[model samples]
Target: MFVRNGTSTLKKVLTCPPTFLDEAAPINEISKKYQDQPLDKAKLLDEYQQLLDAYAEAGVQVEQLTPQESMTNSVFARDFGGCVKEGYILGSFKEPLRYAEHAAYEEKMAELGIPKILEVKKGLFEGGDFAFLRENIIAVGIIERTNMEGFNELKAGLEPLGYQVYPVPADSRYLHLDMCFNLVDDNLAVAYEEGLPTEFKELLNKLEIEIIKVPEEAIFQHGCNLESLGQHRVLSLKQNKDVNNALREHGMEVIELDITETLKAGGGPHCMTFPLHRV
Candidate 1:
């Protein structure tokens, strides 16, 4: 089965081991800070294993894609594609460095026997920009990595499948919508209000979803990018103290993990995962 919504119980996911993640290039605003420092591959692998262990403990099945040495950013598996009720929507990339990663995801999907719902032929649309807010409602980002053309293409394909897709415009610096907005529960979301436009905020308000606003400082740390494990539980970065505390205060279980090595590459727990099956 495919994921019904973002906050639904995540039953299965896809990830790529950081076997070839070696450097932090100037890909985005966040990764630019670590351009001078060298990434520790050993530590990255260990941290990735910890994430895999967490998924196993949470009763979520995991499938791994064969890592390629040339595709360093493939560790951010969420950008490859997105899974829907019908099948998978293969993504297109804006950065030339990531263009080849598309074929890898297609091969993995075919190997897993997951059919393709849409291939996103027109414009750039990464999985990080797409999120299923509910069973039929989806919020996609119009940011540096994704454009209006991509949003329209996705809407045209999914609307026929009973999905309503909304475009959320955000600052290009934010990279993707998940960087500032992510659903943690059926009626709860974490967001960096300053980075989002008024229309998106109004949409959330119309849906009656409570927003846990993160501070501006936390935005660079990818604090809003968290994975919901269903049942009011979430996997977050250990350094996001304020967000974790806020989640705990809201009666949610927060499982913190040390992923400093991986963070140097401008991704968080949510970015490292691609949801496959959820209910």
Candidate 2:
């Protein structure tokens, strides 16, 4: 039984190694907006290993995903799908380069005996735009990676399952909601206020969730993206010092790793992982 509530402590996670093709893919095609420097193969592999180690040190079981030789962006495994109470929801990709990534995931999910609750093939709907603010409340960002059709499909699938889907307009600058806002603790979150819509903030207020605003410039550094190890523990990028310090002040234990090479690919800890079970 795979289950995840997004904000809870992570117990098991799915990840993929930074394969040769992943780092060899055309950098321009992968992240045109960021125009990141070409990744160093050796450095990228080391950084990915450290990410897996962080989960191990936190007592979270790690399941390595099958790498796709023809795909470059498959290393960002979180975008492939999301784990729900019953099983998994296969996510659709907005970037043409990543469209084929989900096929590998389908095979893997089936091998693991996980059922597909929904397969969003109508339009683009990357998993990075989805998060659970509460068990019954799910927030989905209608961004470049996830469109209205995808949002509607998500709502249609989830609403019948007793979830209230809240749509947050995208800022365009941030590819996903996770880049601007992340649920840290039970009722606390780190957010890039400028990147989020006013209605999104108002919704958080209505839920009485505490929000810590990260500096605008830090959004590119993925300050709002981190992985929870449950019990207020987090896996964060050491380069995101300001946000790490802030999380520490809030009484969360932060395990930091330097992922400069990984960051060049435009993903942090949260983007690199797909949680299968959370406590």
Candidate 3:
């Protein structure tokens, strides 16, 4: 749960880093495999800072990322929960090879001034795949990165915090809920028309939220990724053409920034910025 704002609101968001547990745990290996990234690694860090700058420029209060051991995948860094009063739930990284990703969140949360970090021993939960749909209900994607154990942990922990958790089956290709849908605003979200199941759409419809259609291929491009900062404010990657159009068409003011490097690592602006609070 990264803050939509800047350092002014650090404690409000939750975040984590990558570590060695799974095959993707060693980042150095990744560097050896890919010689020329479509987006440069050095530039990715700069672009990530730029994305963070945008949030700061927009009155967003950011909490820095949680520190974990070096892992090959940033996806490991993202396997954390939104936020809870008692603490943030660190979901087990479904990639057994990367399962240790959850371990990093504890230190990150402590640095953010939130000392309590909760973990689910019984299930696997991924924050990337969970969405706070309404007052007490959250929609989670049941996939490889997230499992029944994660689902149960999210449900049991968040429900008592006044968040009702629901599971949505996902297409194996994308492997993440954010790859399919994201809460762009309080009343609207960008959803991949084909990436997610029909039942999930039906359930979302039941909540009265308007789902803006984002193409399946676009989602693979990470177009559906977004973060809501209240007051119709949004954080997203500038490269996602279709998603930007969908957000603007809905009358929401968009803050498009560059995060090509970060996204290529399997996440985008939403993945980089851990919003501390919405308001």
Candidate 4:
């Protein structure tokens, strides 16, 4: 059952792999990189398994997704998209070549019994486009990966269930809401204000949300890719020293994963874990 109350209750979750064309087999019009300098198959497999292990160790349930033969090119597959209390909202890739990405997710969600399903077909929506700040409010970015239609679709699907969808206009530096945003807890978050619209900042202030600024270097390094493991706990793929310190000062545990090879293709811990339940 979905937890009605606390972040501490989010102990169970799900994650996908770095099934990008380079990490897995080349599918669709996936880059030539997979066919060119391939990542060591064994190492890639190990990395996926290690991610599984990390979740398992944290007491997070794991449901591994197998890649579709046609959507390997889509980066959405790499991060697994933003998930809500009901279940994972799988992305329908906006990129034409990545359009086939959604077809296979239904079967996986069925296997896991995730009740709700949201698909943005006409509008481009990647997983990185949304951020959950609190149970009622979420921040979504209008970027190349996430569009106005997709954002609207997400709100239509979620708001009826009592979730409030907030929009944050983004620039190129952060292609997705997640690139410069994430909720550490009910009251805390990190953001790159340069990309966050004034309207969104005003909304955050109205809600009494605390904004922790990520340094220019950290934002550039994708520091906003932080994922919450539990209350005051976090997991980051790259070890940005500044981000780590900021998190620590805020009383959050920052665990860094070795993702140099995995992230090169695009994505981090938040993209990997599609949390289905909060225990």
Best by lDDT: 1
Clashes of each: 0, 1, 29, 3
Estimate the TM-score of every prediction. 0.98, 0.94, 0.81, 0.84
TM-score of 3: 0.81
Off by over 4 Å in 4: 3-8, 23-40, 73-82, 87-90
Error in Å for residue 172 of model 3: 1.3
> Which TM-score value belongs to model 2?
0.94
Name the lDDT of candidate 2.
0.80
lDDT (Cα, tens digit) per residue for candidate 1, span 1-279: 687788878899999998888888889998999999989999999999999999999999999998998788898999977888789999899888787789998999899999998988888899999987888999999987889988889999999999999999888888888898999988888998878888888888899999899876676898999999899999999999999999998889998999898988889999999999988
In model 4, the number of clashes is: 3
State how far residue 78 of model 3 sits from its true place (Å). Answer: 3.4
Best by TM-score: 1
lDDT score at residue 213, model 4, on the 0-100 scale: 88
Rank by lDDT, descending? 1, 2, 4, 3
lDDT of candidates 1 onward, in order? 0.89, 0.80, 0.61, 0.65
Error of 1 at 59 (Å): 0.7
Encode model 3's per-residue lDDT on 110-195: one tens digit a residue: 66665455576777666677677764567888865678876776677666666666888877566678777888766688887676
Query: Tens digit of lDDT per residue, candidate 4, span 35-60?
Result: 45666545655667777777777777
